[model samples]
Target: MPQPSQDDLKEISRDYNRLWQFPNCIGAIDGKHCEIICPAHSGSTYYTYKNYFSVILQGAADANKIFIAIEVGGRGKQSDGGTFHYSVLNKLMESGRFNIPPPDMIPGTTCSLPYVFIGDEAYPMKTNLMRPFPERSLNDERRYFNERLSRARKCKCN
Candidate 1:
């Protein structure tokens, strides 16, 4: 799939805000294991934490639950973050070639925030990406952010 353009990202952010009352969110990202027959001579490369042989399908979806980008065939042993780190999408984002819009003031706050993709703890945090605070160290504010981010990321179906 093609990467979302700057205008597309703005619209996606708007839709996300409408859906979950969260601002500056362009999409939610996640990964799934699609079970498959073990490949000949592949060893355990396709073996997953769930104890199955499979391939990973990593995806990013807009607030409307539409996939904007997807990649398949990653080893099932790889975590979502690992798969993402090696993806073409990640390279584009890291190289500033993805065309994400610049940061702006967060809604209802004076602080400026960059538009970002929401994901779970399995993903890394970056200026253009967000993940929940670690559960063990969460205070009230962190808890609130985690709750909101969780709800937004839950837009995807299992």
Candidate 2:
């Protein structure tokens, strides 16, 4: 799929805020392993922790669960973070060409925050990406934040 333009990102952020109450969130990103037959001459490259031959499908979706971008065919043995690190989406983000919007003030707040994509613990925390606080140490505020973040990141499967 084509990269989202700045306008597209803005619209997505609006949807997320309206539907999920997550402000300045442009999308939700995650990876899934799809089972597949072992390829001839391929070694353990496709073998996953789940004990299956598969490929990783990493994707970012809008609040309405529409895919905005995708990267597939990553080795199943790779972690979600590892697959994302080598994805075109990551490259675009790293190069600052993904057209992400600039930082803006939060609604009813003077603090400025950058638009970000919500992901699970599998993904790294970056200026444009958000992950929940570590489970090992959690206060009431952090727990509530994790709950909200998880709600926003949830993608219903068909």
| Predicted structure with the largest lDDT when compared to the true one | 2
| TM-score, cand. 1 vs. native | 0.94
| Model 1 lDDT-worst window of ten | 149-158
**Per-candidate TM-score against the hidden true structure:** 0.94, 0.95
Candidate 1 residues 1-158, lDDT tens each? 77789999999998888888789998898999999999999999999999999999998899998999898988989999999999877888899998889997777789988999999999999999899999899999999889888888896432
- lDDT at position 62, candidate 1: 94
Residue-level lDDT tens digits of model 2 in 1-158: 88899999999998888888889999999999999999998999999999999999999999999999998999989998889889988888888999999998777789989999999998999899899999999999999999888988994422
**On a 0 to 100 scale, what is the lDDT of residue 145 in model 2?**
96
Estimate the lDDT of model 2: 0.91
Evaluated at residue 126, the lDDT of candidate 2 is 89
